[model samples]
Target: MVSCYSSHGMVRQSWDLFSSMRRSGFPGDGFTFSALLGARASSSCSDHAKLLLLLGISVHGLVIRLGLHLDVVVATALLDMYAKCGRVAEASRVFDAMVLRNTISWNAIIVCYGQHGGGKEAFELFVCMMRDGCCPDELTLSSLLSSCADMAAANEATQLHAYIVKIGFQDFLQVGNALIMAYGRNGFVQEATQMFGMIPNPDLVTWSSMVSSFAYLGLAKSAVHLFDRMLQQGIQPDGVAFLGVLSACSHAGLIEDGFKYILLMMRDYKMDPTPQHLSCLVDLLGRSGRIKDAYDFVVNMPFEADVDVIGAFLGACRMRGNIESAKWAASKLFSLKPNDPVNYLLISNTYAAAGAWSELAKVRSVMRNMCGNKVPGCSWIEIGGIVQTFVSNDMILHQSREMQKMMDLVSLVERYCNDDDIICNDPSLV
Candidate 1:
């Protein structure tokens, strides 16, 4: 029966067959559970993991009833299922309740925590695992490094780097790539570059990481240079690598280079540019005041333009104070996203700019008829993971007094300084 399940497929069918043909002679064994768990945990079937979780619970109840030990394979699978389900709390409970914990067990829990944005918790677990005297492995280090990257934990990242070097895992390519990502994300480009140089034979992941790091640092020239070098090394650039290169070109306003890379990606690499790539191109042209060209590009695009693509064009028009173009782009954008209050506000703003008070009134009336509640345009900046959001007039709790005091201060400051050009703060003039 197991042979039949194995021949058909590796996972679900085997379990069904095994349950149906409950041979009295066949005793439940670890190998069978391991194989079944492997099949369930394999990628591409997220639903299977959920089913496995339910089955695992039933198996656990049976084990408890019979006073049987929970096998390591079943334990790991249960942990993985909970983790993948975005139920880290349950996963942790399962992990702690397990009778035996191995390297795989620890690795699963740490990775789950990291992916779920519990970076600080993951780090604490890593330290505790080390204190427990469990020999640190690459999988453990990789998971911890990913957590550090996600949180942009520079100090923790530096310590992890030292630990990796001390453990002699720095030579491993996978570990090196993870470290590169951690350093790159934490704004340590020089350190990331130094690490990249030490990699004897870099793979696609290594090259992609370096390319992304260069792009993130706004060093598009360097990104393009490294891309050329990668091609010379016969390393094929994947979608992510191309995205990094294109983004670099966009950042530096290198239009020609941007077009060249787009052509290379499509013709040379035989890879079609995604919507994001096209949007980047439109944004590059738009921000450079080539609003007409950007508009033409969108109209000529092989696929339908998405909200993002249209928004890029509209923003460019607003930047250039091209009222005609702004109105055109705004019309299309509003049509695409009527439910969005911000789009209505943008159109009204454009109409106000053009001195079309009646059109502005018309827009506001439509908004009122549709939904009287207006979601104001708010801006936010994150400082130390705390987001400070500001709207037109509404103040945060206990901050109104301070806000009033600041307004009085601003009035005093304005009386002493008069500059018409400096009077406005909208960088996008339109």
Candidate 2:
């Protein structure tokens, strides 16, 4: 009963039930506490993460009191709960305290660090897992690869691929799909295509990744071709695949195809449009100068718009120079994501572009009052198989001299080009 309730996110109910059991003199074991922990871990919403962490910590205390913390299964579940709650330090401490562990235990810890942006720490733990003679399964490889892709750590991804081939796990379809995502994210499209070809049979993820890769590169026609091929092969589509298709068609201003596929996804596939799909549709409509239609669509969404959807609407308003729409979207963002500096900066920039000095000042004032300081913009570039990071106004993080020289060269070169003619003419000749 606890397990069932926990899996469905009824954490409070599970706790009440557990309290009743405890009042009856029933001392819960590892499994009972594990179920409770699983309930808290099931939530993927960031807004509720802190509250869930508090509840999970309470459960951890009970597990320790019952002397069940040493139980491998219970410890693993406890670590997973911490990981899902965004408490990487607590998860690592729990993992290290374990006296015995299995593949699942190791995978849980790896996933904890990997998903939390500690890709290097996660990779080091993978090495430790090998030294301890715990064999890694497909889950381990896929999880680690996912982190590598998120970081665009091409070097690490390549190393993992070699290890996968050495261990003969390269043929696994899931691993193959991960490799495609990693390579594509790292700017190695040829390698991603090669991996895609090696998969004897492509699944939904494989097609989605392929489509997204092309769409990201603005290769809309190629993405459409791939979608057509997937349909010919009779592979079922999912929400994610539609997201890619919508993004691709929107980028190319293929509004008809975007709406056509979205309708097909809803009517034929019986899948509701994800927030990302809605965002893409907004972008498509905006690109085609359908500002009013896009605004109406957003207003009529069955559910409240999430961050992505609102951001997309804001971007469309900015692109079309619709200050009223941009201001409305900005108001939505102020309440939805008050702390994220990106949203504040975007609205301020839009206001500045439209010559709304008072509104721009207000946004900056709100940002100062709410966030205290601007978050330095950060970006990554993979050069010659190595990924380098640079933060705005921080030169010492990488090769400061080389980057400074590049910036100087770009600033000098831009002065010679006419903005009106530059778009259609060769930049080199300009």
Candidate 3:
């Protein structure tokens, strides 16, 4: 009853029933206690989790005080509670104090670590489990593989792949899909493709993974072809599948193809275009300089065009130097997200480029009056097994000093033509 109520978000009712049960002095067993903990954890009430912890601790204290047995099930529930409550440290403490540990205990802790971005710790624990002669089952490998993939540990992922093959789990669809995701995420598109092909009976997830792999690698044409083949093979495309198709079409500048798929999605499949699909379409059309069509589409959209959709159109207008459309898009974007600095910057840049000095001044003045906050630009690079992120105009290691030197060199370049007309007509002539 507690689990059902919690699952349905009826926290008050769950607690009321629990309170009544406690008042009746009915002794709660392990399952009842676990359910109570789950209800408390999933409740929307603030501090419900903390109250649950207190109740659990009290129960545990009573159990120890009364010399009751410390069973693995109770310990696992306790660990799960602590982990879910964002107290992984407490969870680890409980695990350490366990008199008997099982694979479930290990899996819970590993999942907690993965959720908290402690992938390295999870992987290390897996190693320790193996060193202690504990055999990992499919669940264990699945958890480890997910962590490795999220952390982009390609070498570790490859080793796990080898282990899966050795253990005859290579044919397992779930495992193969995970391997595909890992390889694609780590930029090993070729390896991911091979793994996808090796899955003899590919499910929807398998097909989506292959299509997404191409999308991620920017092989948009190949992705489109794969989606076509999937349809030809009678594989029904899900939302994720369409997302890949639309994303591929967007990146490859296949505006016509994207528009076709959007219509096909509604006509043949009766699937409504999600906000993501709409945003992609707007981006596609706007970037292709079909500003009027993009604007009309957004204006006539059945659902509200979210800030993301408007931003997409705005960015596309900026990229194409369509100052008129950019101003219009900016108005919609600013109305939707007034405090978004990127929109303000984009509008200001557009106005300045169009020689609307007064408009540019007004835009910049508005930005200045709106708390003086500006959006910062950032870039990331991965090298030698490490990823480095840097913000614009911020000193980023060796690059900061080198940047000034490059700017100085650019300033000193010889000018072949000083005439504005010639420079505008043919910059390469210089």
Candidate 4:
């Protein structure tokens, strides 16, 4: 009954049954505790992780008391639970203490690090897994590739791709999809295209990844063309695929085509417009200089406008110099994301652009009082297979002195250009 309840995702009921069993002098085994832990992890409540972690810890205590801590299955479940709760360190500790390990154990810990942006650590663990004679399967490679994508480690991803091909896992659907995503995210568009081509029978995920890759690379026509090909091939389009198409249209400013696709999605495909779809529509219209229409669209959206939708509208307002609309959108954004500094920054910039000095000052004052220091804008670039990140006013880089000198030179050039405008009348000189 507890297993049934847990399987059905009735977390509270499962817990109740578990308590009742214990009260009735039924000492459950590892399987029972594992079921309860799985149910706890699957709970969809708002406070999911916090509540799930508490239950997981309790179950872990019970496992230790029952001398089942070394059981592979139970230990794996504990590792997964900790990882899901963002307690990667605790998960690592559990992983290290396990007397017996399996591929599942390694995969769990590697995935934990991968999902949490510890790509380097995940890579190290993969190497250790190889040394420990634990042959990695597709899941292991896919997880590591995903981490590479997150870190924009193109070189690492390429090496992994070579390794996957050598191991004959290149044709595997999941690995192919992960490779496509990793290559695309790392700016290896050609490699992503090749990966897509290598998949003989592409699924919806494959097609979606390829289309999104093109869209992200600003090749909107290619993205749209691929979507058409996908349709012609009789593969059904899901919300994600539609999002790629819509994003492509937005980026390319194909307003009419975007609307047609939206209508097609609704009328023919029976797909409702999600917030992401609405955001793309807003961006499309706004970028095409139809700010009023974009605002109206947001106002009349069937679903409540989320932060992304409002942010899109706010961005449009900023572009079109609609101070009133921008102000209203910023307020909505503030309510939705009170702690987000971008909202305050956008509003302040909009006010400044409109010469509303008093309003700009007020916004700045509010930001200073409520949000404290604004986070510096940061960006990263990959050179020689190493990704280096830089932040505005950063002082931690190894070549900070050289960077400062470059910045000083650029500032000087800007000041000089602004103060004195020299013109050459000779055509040859021009």
**Who wins the TM-score comparison?**
4
Compose the digit string of candidate 3's lDDT tens values, residues 218-331. Answer: 899989999999999998888889988898888788998998888889998999989898999998887677888888988899988888888888777777778878888888
Tell me the tens digit of each residue's lDDT in model 2 across 1-430. 8888888888778988999999999988888988988988897777777888888898899888888999999999999998888789999999999999999999999999888888878888999999999999999999899888888898889989999999999999989999988888777889998999999988989999998888877889989999989988999988788888899999999998999999999999899998989999998998888999999989999999988888988888888789999989988998998898888988888888889899899989989989888767789876775567777777586578887899887876675454646645756644
Write candidate 4's Cα lDDT for 1-430 as tens digits: 9989998989889999999999999989989988887786666576566777888899999999999888998899899888878889999999999998899999999999999989989999999999999999999999999998888898899899999989999989999999999999878899999999989999999999999989988999999999999999999999999999999999999998899899989999999989999899999999999998998999998878999999988888887788999999999998988878888988888888889999999999988887889878889877886778898777899899998899897886666556434323324324
Q: Write the per-residue lDDT of candidate 1 for residues 248-364, one digit (tens) a residue.
A: 888888899899999999999999998888888988897787988998999999989988788777766766777788778778877888777777777777677768899889989
Please count the clashing residue pairs in each candidate, in the order shown.
0, 0, 0, 0
Off by over 4 Å in 1: 1-41, 44-69, 305-430
Evaluation by TM-score, superior candidate among 1 and 4? 4
Tell me the deviation in Å of residue 54 in model 3: 13
TM-score of each: 0.70, 0.85, 0.71, 0.89
Lowest lDDT 10-residue stretch of candidate 4: 420-429
lDDT values of the candidates?
A: 0.79, 0.88, 0.79, 0.90
Q: Give stretches of model 3 more than 4 Å off.
A: 3-16, 36-102, 112-140, 143-152, 327-430
Q: List the residue pairs that clash in candidate 3.
A: none
Model 4's number of clashes is: 0
lDDT of 1: 0.79
Off by over 4 Å in 2: 1-17, 43-52, 300-306, 354-359, 382-387, 398-430
